[model samples]
Target chain A: AQTIHQWPVAEIKAVGSPLSLGCTIKGKSSPNLYWYWQATGGTLQQLFYSITVGQVESVVQLNLSASRPKDDQFILSTEKLLLSHSGFYLCAWTTNSDYTFGSGTRLLVI
Target chain B: AQSVTQPDARVTVSEGASLQLRCKYSSSVTPYLFWYVQYPRQGLQLLLKYYSGDPVVQGVNGFEAEFSKSNSSFHLRKASVHWSDSAVYFCAVSYRGSALGRLHFGAGTQLIVIP
Candidate 1:
């Protein structure tokens, strides 16, 4: 069975603090990975997507960067967290058509 | 460019009543359609999908959606609702054919099942 796991289910930090969110997919190899952000009560916005290890494409600019160091691991990070960055972050993996999403990480920037 | 539209921001319905959520889409070509449900604070779960076929697809929990290319609409339906069915429903479209593609999601409709 395929499963997607996200680390640090929730986070609270200062405005300038650094942040890192991770996602991993098990039982699937070389799958496409994507990052999405959703506001408290808004629709989802695509951030970045990776087709393979060491290659990622940015769909939008939100002052965030993503990396796929391993085939099944994706990391989203930033040097400074802004108040506007507080929301729900989700990771998704897809190959053919159907996309499966991770549980998500809730971040609150104080 | 592809986009999805879900007109209703929120819907309130009584338990045991039939449900309908409307969706409209715009794409240059035929796309893969899907319905997903999200709990209060959880990831999205696929309710059903429409690739290319009978125009009506059945999903889990007795949920179904009809696809109409002429109207560019995909409407979700349920025979009866339960209190546990209260959640946010989203309609998405993808244009990838045997390849990698990003999903375009609608604003989403919040379903409130009143007991």
Candidate 2:
């Protein structure tokens, strides 16, 4: 089975501060990677997806950017944060089969 | 374009009562359907998937979903739901013959089971 790990379970930052989130997948090579955002008790919205390294696609521009540095690692970063950017961010991996989601990081922008 | 619709935004039922959550999709070809459960503050977990096999498929925790091509629906059903079954359900669809498996998810239906 494939396992995905995400760092910094929770985060609180100021509006102008920079932010970064990390995700790593094990046991699956070159799998499809995705970024999603969700509010409390709300539905999930896809943010980005990457099929291979150095390639990323944006679904919704919440002033966040995604990058696939390595085959097993995906990173979400922003130079500055917005108050509306506060939400739960999730990382997932799929291989033409079922998807495995990370635990997710709860973000609060003050 | 492929999209999913979860008709009921919220559903409430008593324990031991039969449960059904409706999910409909719009696609031109035969779409691959999936049902997932998300516990409070947790990530989505796969409950079941329907591809080319039997129209009815069983999943973990006594959950089953049936696929209907004519209606373009994949409805989840359970004979008797438990309190533990209370969670948000998401319906996803993938393009037929799709090797990428990028899923388009529905807004999700919130299920509440009373004890």
Candidate 3:
């Protein structure tokens, strides 16, 4: 069984502030990692995905960037936050036969 | 681009009653479809999935879904509903062979079970 961990359950950021959200996976080998954003009343959209270490592809960029620094560690970051950057951010990983998601971080940018 | 649609934003059902929630999807190939449940203020949990073979798949908690290729739909059904079954259910699809097998999720339908 694999587990995904995400930190800072909720966040409130001001405009132009830096942001970082982290996710770590357990019990997997070279798994595919993903980042998803769920905006208010909006569907879940794939933000990024990484197949291996040090490689990530952005599906939809909303001034946000993702990095897979290690095999089990994936991070979502932003240099500056905009009001539109607020939403529920989810970190997920896929094993050969299953998919699992972290608790998610809810960001509210004022 | 693969997409999924969960038509019912909200559905209310009585406990011990059978329940069904509709989900429609768009994909070029036979996409990997999934059903996930989200409790209030909680992250999403995978309830079941469909890869290939059987059109009808059984899932956790007495829940099952049938894939209708002609209808492009995967509707979840439960024999008996419980109050704990109330949650937001999301339908998702993913490309099978892509390196980036990203799961495209639906807007999600909130199911409310009344006792």
How well is each residue in B33-111 modelled by candidate 2, as lDDT tens digits? 8898989877789999987889999999999999999999999999999999999999998786664557788989999
Give the true-contact fraction for every prediction, in order.
Answer: 0.61, 0.61, 0.82
Q: How accurate is candidate 2 locally (lDDT)?
A: 0.90
> How big is the RMSD of model 2?
1.5
Q: Which model scores highest in DockQ?
A: 3
Clashing pairs in 1: none
What TM-score did chain B of candidate 1 earn? Answer: 0.96
Residue A21's lDDT within candidate 2 is 98
* Candidate 3 error regions (>4 Å): none
User: Across residues B31-70, which tens digit of lDDT does each residue of candidate 3 receive?
Assistant: 8889999887788898899999999999999999999999
lDDT of each: 0.93, 0.90, 0.90
Highest TM-score: give the candidate number: 1
Every model's DockQ = 0.74, 0.65, 0.78
Candidate 1 has what TM-score?
0.98
